[model samples]
Target: MNSFAKVITTLIGSFTLLIWVGKLDPAPYPLTYPSNFGNRISIPQNNPTTQAGVYLGRNLFYEPLLSANNKISCGSCHEQKRAFTDGKVFSSGVDGTLTSRNSMALVNLLWARRFFWDGRATGLEAQAAFPLSDPHEMGQALTVSAAKLRQSPKYPILFQKAFGDTAITVNRITMAISQFERTLISADSPYDRYLKNTYKPSPIELEGMRLFNTMPQPRKKIRGADCAHCHGGAKTYLELFHNNGLDEISTDKGIAAITGMDSDHGRFKIPTLRNIALTAPYMHDGRFNSLQQVLDHYSEHLKQKHLSPFLKGSSNKIGGTSLQLSAHEKKAVIAFLNMLTDTTFIHNPEFSNPNHP
Candidate 1:
């Protein structure tokens, strides 16, 4: 063959060899969003989504070896059935120590700009690393975790498949788990279908939705529940944190711990209303047991000091901020909140524990 022909042939031969040895670039994982979700998926360029990477993440999420005692995993607190929440007021660690705050559900994490109730971690990967080292949580060092996963016969292979190498690092582990979590989009709720005109809300549910979206304005004669202000928008939910007037005196000091500002005291991430019915014992500390209690707090028991501006005309304790919802209105709002539950995401086989499955 001529010189140019030989060069082309050599390139082809190398490419074929790489493919044969399973070193070729793998295809990306198919991540689909519902029509109502819109264009809101923000994945980091470094940790791009791939089938192998997401699969590795799924395995690591359920791996107990990441814990100090080899008994706790990410799935230990974020169960699949209860919308990724542990269904407890406070999630317990491997040593039976309780977390300070309620375990936030892990749905629709791709849309979240911050993680955790207090908005401590800026991204999902950073959020994943905290529990591993938290004394009350997993209580394992990153170095120890890397060593334990390296010692595992299955993890190295999974790591190689995900990142094209057998080296297991904390960054890689977190990236994989974050990839898996980004796929946990929950948009197929009854309310989502209603928005698409595929499902119609019941009369009470319709009333609740109306109340939720509208803010009460005595000047303009507009009676509203005013919930959509904080939990509103076209996408999954708002990423902002708010002090919902849960108490007159803040106990945990919430986001203030991170910002060290009294203005930020009691401010917590406004969790997505989607699957709100399943994530019971609501609020940062899981102070309310039922949705009714939550509504009652807003309608009749809300404190005035440090209340979010969104609740200016909706909180019961504040003169101008009170929503003043009647018994019927409160029940209707509860019905609408229930419509946000998405059943498909929880039962998805892809999100199930790989070893258990």
Candidate 2:
């Protein structure tokens, strides 16, 4: 290659590298998962549990210093009251720009294999960086975040205790925060009680549970609607990402967006039913405003060229063997779902922001 060509390539590479590492100069660039109870959380081995690390991490989670403007923290959107979700169709970013998808709840994130509606992030450690740099989200770059945290009076001691005097780094920060988040646990729901045999279920709830577990096929003896197939077993829920046929053609194209797999289009991770009543506006887009609407969606909205074939009826009905239940039956199912709500989890003081307290 000619010397001029080599020099041009070197300059371009340097510029790209600079852009990647560049912080906000207005200064210049930027800032910055899940817990137990259900199955969505998976605590990494590198950052194991410790009182000091968790304490520091929790402080960071609620601290607005992670963002460039010092106005937003992780808790700003993932409010504990709304089951760790913002209750909006899409999450608002740092500069008032909105993201394309709803902010996912941080419940039981330890069991989730992927993060986001599209499953874009492969790990909790890597996932922390996506929102911080998004101009719409935290509006700060990673390099900027390192410098800011390093200069912070509060974070250095945290870094030392958490990592034995490791430098303030993006990797260390993410790990620490993730360790703290993984401590958010909620396994005391009514469903959990039922599993533990500590509490008795109501009559209607019993029937609904039976129906949910072993309801018959709608038309013929093809098959019954098995809630356990996806949402199954003792946990009362599974953490699989599925299209579930929420839409015939989803523009968001959930898992497909990340993996570039055509079949995974419009698929999203299955949310646990724990506290289902409280976390309203269901689905990836928060389209269902009510639990009744969610039930109605399952009952009436399942359609061909849209829903998964697994849910289709023996007669190839639009919705999987339409439950076509009467209002009373619907009420029964709703009642059963309500049993999953745990007042203790909602009111838990440990999960709340210590700064606010």
Candidate 3:
């Protein structure tokens, strides 16, 4: 070919490339952290969140098309308004099928090492696939869902934007959804504000905080709620499993179901208390409808045999550790728990459902 012709062909190819780039609507969605969050966020190496990826994830999460019946989406159970929980004892699936356990809150999932009440799934990407095929949840196969997504005009573009290609797969779908979930970091509560010196806790709340952090020392008579032992405090909550004296004999078996170990019986993942006020109907089985009931479980009804060793009674052999909080103390604890509710998180427009289909 002549030099002039080659130069002309190159110019035409450059123009075509520019036009193609302009036609595509892929946008970068970088994850942002609040200054108050400190140095806590540790994104997984494989699924570092991108703006386009998160956008795709949010859409996929809300898309009911993933279900067999095209009637249930991840958002159906994990509603943002209720801090991503369906506010039911067990979340209903397609055709009114109910999940075995309560839908867990999706708040601050980035710090989570294990997913689900039983911790069946290890990574968030793996976790996203569970409900897609669960008989009681979305009730659809990921392969079938991936095929459907591939045929969708909207989803292909989303896939291309997020993953640098138009090819759709179950892994990509799970990764995208997981990326969106990773961005669901909740850290702007009143407790967070107090830490930053932007807000001051109420007197009762301060008292509640004191009790929550205080470890019970019977010798010194420092009777405390000791909630921070499990739930942690203003920062990100701990990700530990415990048999918090919920059952004398295990029916659900919780972690034991996964491990097939008698010692793990009745042990369940301890969820974050960041949005404790909003995520009611507490515990793995959703036995308690209110925070008061949860506190009561700790204070009065704590079981002895299978209780976590962290509890006061587990070591003393006096039975399970009971906070034995007074009515006023319980009220104070509830009040402090209310402060954990991050209004900003629940109402964030970015986290809400998209307007268009």
Off by over 4 Å in 2: 1-41, 219-225, 314-321
lDDT for each candidate structure:
0.85, 0.70, 0.83
Provide backbone clash counts, one per model.
6, 21, 1
- Candidate 3: list runs displaced more than 4 Å: 1-28, 34-42, 312-321
TM-score of each: 0.91, 0.82, 0.89
TM-score-superior candidate, 1 or 2? 1
Pairs in steric clash, model 1: 312-321, 313-321, 314-321, 314-323, 315-321, 315-322
Model 1, TM vs. native? 0.91
Q: Please give the range of 10 consecutive residues that has the lowest summed lDDT in model 2.
A: 25-34
Clashing pairs in 3: 29-51
Candidate 3 residue lDDT tens string, 1-357: 999999999999999886564343445456565665555665678776887889889999999899989988999999898999988898887757778888899988877778888888888988999998887889899999999988887887777777777889988999999989988978888988888889999999998888777776656667678888888755547878889888889788999988988888999898988888898799988999999999888888888778877773622123335767788888888888888999999999888888542
Residues 262-282 of candidate 2: C-alpha lDDT, one tens digit per residue: 877787877777677777778
Q: Rank all candidate structures by their lDDT, best first, as comma-separated numbers.
A: 1, 3, 2
Candidate that would win on TM-score: 1
